[model samples]
Target: MQWNDYRLVLAVARARKLPEAAEALGLTVSTMFRRIERIEELMERPVFHRERGIYTPNEVGDELCRAAEQMEQAAFAAERKVLGSSSLVSGTLIVTSSEVLGAFFLSRHLTDLASYHPGLDVQLHSGNEVLSLAHREADVALRSSRPMDSSLFGRKLSDIHWAVYGDAKSSARLSASSDFRHERFVGFSSSPFADHMSAIQRTVFPDGIVSLSSNSLVLTASSAQKGAGLAVLPMVLGEQWPGLFRLTEPIEQIAGELWIVCHQDMQNNPRVRLAFDALISGIERDRSLFVGDSV
Candidate 1:
C-alpha cells in the first residue's frame, strides 16, 4: 500500500534473495524480513515463495509489484508537473536505448547538453535488453520499436537503415548477397522482424541467413571489424570507425524506424524535456544515414 513497501518488493524481485534485496535498500536482513512479514500479514497470504534461499514472487506478489510500479510512476509524474519550468532541474536523467544508440549517439548529445547545463547529471544505459519505463527504470528511452504504453508518449524520430558492413581487410571476401549469407552473422536471438519485444534485432539479416547470431550489435560490429563475420550496421556507426566498408548500396540495406518514448510522469521535467529535445534534434541532423521509408 505504501511506496516503501512497493520499493521493497521491487528490490526483492530484482535481487531474488532477501540479503541481496536488503543490501540494495541499505537495510538489515531482519528488517527486510519484517517488512515482507508485514505485507503478508496484511494480505493474509504469502506474496512470495522461497526455495533453496531464492525468493520468487507468487501471482499476487507479481500483481502487487506491477501495481506498485504504476503508482510510483504516477507519483513521479505528478511531482514533475507540479515543479514545472521553474524547477532547478537537478536529478539523474536515466536514459535507455539499444547498444548502438547508447554507445555511439546518446553520449555525444548528452555531452553537448552537459556543457549547456552543468547542473544536470545524466546516466545513459545501453544494452540489448529494454528497461521497464513504467517502473521508472529510465526517465527517457530511445527505442527501435513503438512503445505499447498508451499513457506514455511515443514519437517516431527517424528510420534506421542498415547495410552489410565489414572492415577493409575483409573487403576481399565480400560480394554483397552470397558474401553476407556465407559469412558469420551477428544478430540478437530476437529481432524486430521476429517476436522480440523490440525491433533492434529484426533487421540484422534482412536476407534471412544469419550464419552467426549474437544479441549484441556492438559484438556484431566488432566481429565484422575483425573479419569474424558480416554485420548489419548503421551508416553512422560504420563512418565512425574508419576502414569499415559497406558491402552493398545504401538503398539495398535493411531499415527500420526509431522512436523516442518517455514516461508521462517525467515528461514535464525540464531536464528530461531538454534531453528529449536534444535527442530529437540529433537524430534529425543525421536522418539521411538511417534507412527506412518514412521518418
Candidate 2:
C-alpha cells in the first residue's frame, strides 16, 4: 500500500521472525506485530501466514517484497549518485576487510588517513563475509579476491603468500626432516581458501592430522602459537606473531590475490578517492610483507 508497508513485508519475509525483523528496523516486537496487523487490515487480506514464530509471506506479500527490493535498490543508487557528486573529502567512509587484515595491517593506515582528514569518519568492518558495493553496504573493500562486478572498480594490491607456521620447537622439528606425514596441523573450518589449503595439505602430506580447525584465521594462528599444530597462514600474519615461525617457504599453489575495490560511482567522491589512494599507498609500501619478501 505504501513504502513503509512494502518495507515491513520485505523485512518479515527476509527475517522470518517478527522479533528479528523488528530489531532490524529498530522497532519493538509488539510494535512490529501491530503494524503488520494494521497493514493486513488496510489491504483487506492476509499477507503472511504465521506459525511457530515464523512468518511466511503469502502471494500478496511476495509481490510487495519484490517491489520493496526494487525500491531499496533505487534508493541506494540515488544515494550513491548524490555522494559521488560531492568533491569534498568529508563524511563517513565504510571499509571492509578480513579480521586479520584489518587488525594487523589496514587499521593503522586508515587511522592515519582519518587523522589527516579531520572531516573524514572512518568505519572499519572486519569480517570474512564480502559486503556488496552495489548495495552500498560498504564504501571500500580490501579483499582476498578481485572484484567480479562490472559496476565496481578494483586495483590489484599483491599476491598474498602463505606458509607453514608453527611454534619454535615445532618449527625446528619440522625443519629437520622433509617428511610431514606425521605432523599435526591447525586448519580452516570454512572458506574457499580453506578448501584450497586442505586439498594442498592432502596432496602434500596425506597422513598429516588436522588437530584443530577454526573459521577465523586469527584463531587458527593462535592455535598454532599455542603449539596445537602447524598452520598454513598468510605470510603477513605469520611473520608478525611473536612465538610463531615459518616452517616452510611460501606455498605458491595456494597463493591468494589481494584487491582494493569500490563501486565505480564512488570513485570520484573526494573522501572515497582519498581513502582509496591511502590504502593503495599503504599496502604498496608494505608490499613485501604481503608477498613474504619481508621475512
Candidate 3:
C-alpha cells in the first residue's frame, strides 16, 4: 500500500533472498518478513512463491514489481530535477565513453570538476560500446563522432589521432616495407571501431599478421609493450608508456572527431551544463593531447 512497502516487495523479489534484500534496505530480516506478510495481507493475495527459502515473483508479483520500478525511477528523477534547478552545480551525472579516453582523459577532468563542486558526483560508463542517451542510459557521452540520433545534440571538442605503436625494443626494426609482411598486430576484439581498425591493418600490416585481438585497450597496450606486435592505439593512450614506440605519424584513416553529447532536454539542466562545460574546458586546455601534438 505504502511506497516504502512496495519497495520492500520489489527488493525482496529481485534479490530472491530475504536476508540480502533486508541488508540492502538497512532493515533486519525479521522486519523484512513482517513487511512482506503485511503487504500480502493488504493485497489479499500472495506476491511471492516461496520454495527452499527462495522467493520468486508470481504473475501478480511481477506486475507489481514493474510498477514499483517505474515509481522508483520517477522518485529519483524528481529529486535530480529539483537539484538541477538549484543554484548549486551538483547532482549525479552518468557519462559514457570509450575505455581508453574515459580512463586516460575524461576521468581526470571529471575528478577535477568533482573537486571543484564537492556536491557533484559522476558515474562513468567506460567501454567500447556506446550507450544511447535517448534511453536515459547515460546523462552525457564523451565520444568520437556525433550521434546519428536527431534528438541528441553535441559540440565537437577536438580531433583524436590514432597511430601505430609497438614495443620499444622490438619495434625498432619496424617499417612500412616488405618486412611488414612478417609483423603481427594486436587488434580490437569487439568495438564500433572494428572496421576502422581493420582499415588501419590493411594499410600497415598488409600481410594481415594480426596475432591477437582483445576487447580492452589496456590489454592491447600491454600486448604491444610485450612485443606481441604493432597496435593501432589512440595517441593519448599509446604515449603513456615509454616502453611503447609510435611507429608513424597519426594515421589519417583512423582519426576520430571527439564530441561531448547529450539529449536535447538535458541542454538546460544546470548540473549537466556544468559538467558539459567542464569537459569542453578541459579538452580545450589539453587539445594537443588529442591530436598527438604534445605526446
Candidate 4:
C-alpha cells in the first residue's frame, strides 16, 4: 500500500472513531469512509471491524500500523536532518505553550521575534495539551515540565510558583478562618495539569468545595476575580489580575518549572536556534516574574 494508505490505517487505529481520524487527517468523514473501503478492496481483506461507529483494527491492520509507525519515524528523521543542515533563518516556526503563558507572557516575545526576523513567520499554538517536538507537532515549546525524551533538548527557565487567589472579599473571608476546609474553590476541569491540581486540593483541603471548574486558567483566574471562589493559580497570572489577591503563600506541592524545549535535531537550525536564544533571554529578563518575586 502507499504511504497515504498506511497513514490512513494508522490514524483510524489511533482514533478508533472515524470522525476523529478524519479530522486528524483533514478529511471529511465521508471521504475517510470511502478511502477505507477502497483500501480494503485493494488489500482483498477487511482491516478493521466496524461496530457502532467505532473502528477496531484487525491483525492485518495492526501489522500495517507497525510498518506505518516505522515509516513515519524515518520520514521525520529525514525531514529533521534536512532542516537542521539549513542555515536559513527564514521559515515558519511553530511555538507551543499553555494558554495562560502564551496569552499573558509569550505573545509579546514572539511578536518581537517576528519583527526581528522579517522573513520568519511565527505561529503560536496555545493549549493545555503538550505537543510533541519529536513528531514535529511544534518546533519549540515552553512547557511546565522538562522534556524526558533523550532526542530533545530542554532548558529550565524558572520555577513557576503556584498560590491560592481570590477577590478582596473572598480573601478577607478566607483569612478570617484558618480552616481551609470550610472554603470554596475554583478548580481546573479536564486538562493535563487538572489531575495534579486535584490531587493537591484533595491532600491540602479535602473538604473544600469546587464551586467552579474550567480548563482555561484565564477563566479560572477570572472566576476568582469575580469572587466565584479561591483558585490555585500561577503567581505570574494571579498577580496580574487587578481584583484578585494572593490568598495563600506559594503552594510548594503544586509548583512546577518552566522549560524551553525542542527536538535535538532542530536545535541546530538557524531559525530554531535564534528563536531559542531569544526566548531564553526574554525568560531570563523576567525570571523574577516567573518565580513570583516581582510582585
The candidate 4 region of ten consecutive residues with least summed lDDT is 286-295
Candidate 4 — what's its lDDT?
Answer: 0.85
Candidate 3's residue-wise lDDT over 1-295, tens digit each? 9899879989998899999999989999999999888989998999999999999999989988999989987875665455445666676878888888887887878877677878788788888676867557788898688667887878898888888788876555764332456578887767666777777778766885888997777889988899888888888788775688877777777788888988776677777887788888898777766787522
Score candidate 1 by lDDT. 0.72
- Residue 67 in model 3: lDDT: 92
Cα lDDT listed for each candidate: 0.72, 0.85, 0.80, 0.85
Which should have the higher lDDT, number 1 or number 3?
A: 3
| Per-residue lDDT over 185-282 for candidate 2, one digit per residue giving the tens place of the 0 to 100 score | 88777765678778887876688899888887888899999989988888889888889988777777778989889899888888788877887888
What's the CA RMSD for each of the models? 4.9, 2.0, 4.2, 3.1
Q: Provide the clash count, candidate 1.
A: 10
Question: Residue-wise lDDT of candidate 1 within 120-198, one digit each (tens)?
Answer: 7788898767787766778789987777888688789877766667777657765655434335555555554334412
What's the count of clashing pairs in each model shown? 10, 0, 0, 0
Worst 10 residues of 1 by lDDT: 193-202
Question: Worst ten-residue run, lDDT, model 3?
Answer: 171-180
Candidate 2: list runs displaced more than 4 Å: 174-179, 190-193
lDDT of 4 by residue, 167-192 (tens): 98976666623557768899888877
Q: After aligning candidate 4 to the native by TM-score, how far in Å is the CA of 146 from where it should be? A: 2.4
